[model samples]
Target: MSIMLKEMKAGDQGRVQGFAAGGQAYRRKLLAMGLTPGVEFLVVRVAPMGDPVEVRVRGTSVSLRKDEAATLNVERMP
Candidate 1:
């Protein structure tokens, strides 16, 4: 099953499925950040205010805004 990226907690592992309905430019931006479909990522941290969520992707850490993370559809890994 797929869930919004923002809903995932730290230490969770998941694969990027795709993006939710939104802007093409935003999609392109995310893609450039290595969030392409089928890519796996590990949730590293979530701020106390829950504004920025950090994840390890392609061997690098990326911080995404809450709304930006929400736009990603991801499937939890076992």
Candidate 2:
């Protein structure tokens, strides 16, 4: 069960599965920010309107816009 990263709510835990259809440059940008495949991350917070989502990965918090997050595929942890 993979879902878009933007669909995850605050406190959700998941691992990066891959990415949705998008540009390679965009994907590479995310990879450089530590969102590579198989990386486990926790959703730290979501804005009231859900524009910016904060996730903790590799011991650091990264904020992503909704559009940016939508390109990521993640599988929630049990």
Candidate 1, position 77, lDDT: 95
Clash count, predicted structure 2: 0
Which residue pairs in model 1 clash with each other?
none
Q: CA lDDT of 48 in candidate 1?
A: 88
lDDT of 2 by residue, 1-78 (tens): 999988889989999999888646578889999999999999999999998999999999999988879889999997
Per-residue lDDT, model 2, residue 7, is 86
- TM values, all candidates: 0.94, 0.94
lDDT tens per residue, model 1, 3-71: 999888999999999999874657888999999999999999999888799999999999999878888
Reference-based lDDT, residue 61, model 2: 97
Quote the positional error of residue 2 for candidate 1 in Å: 0.9
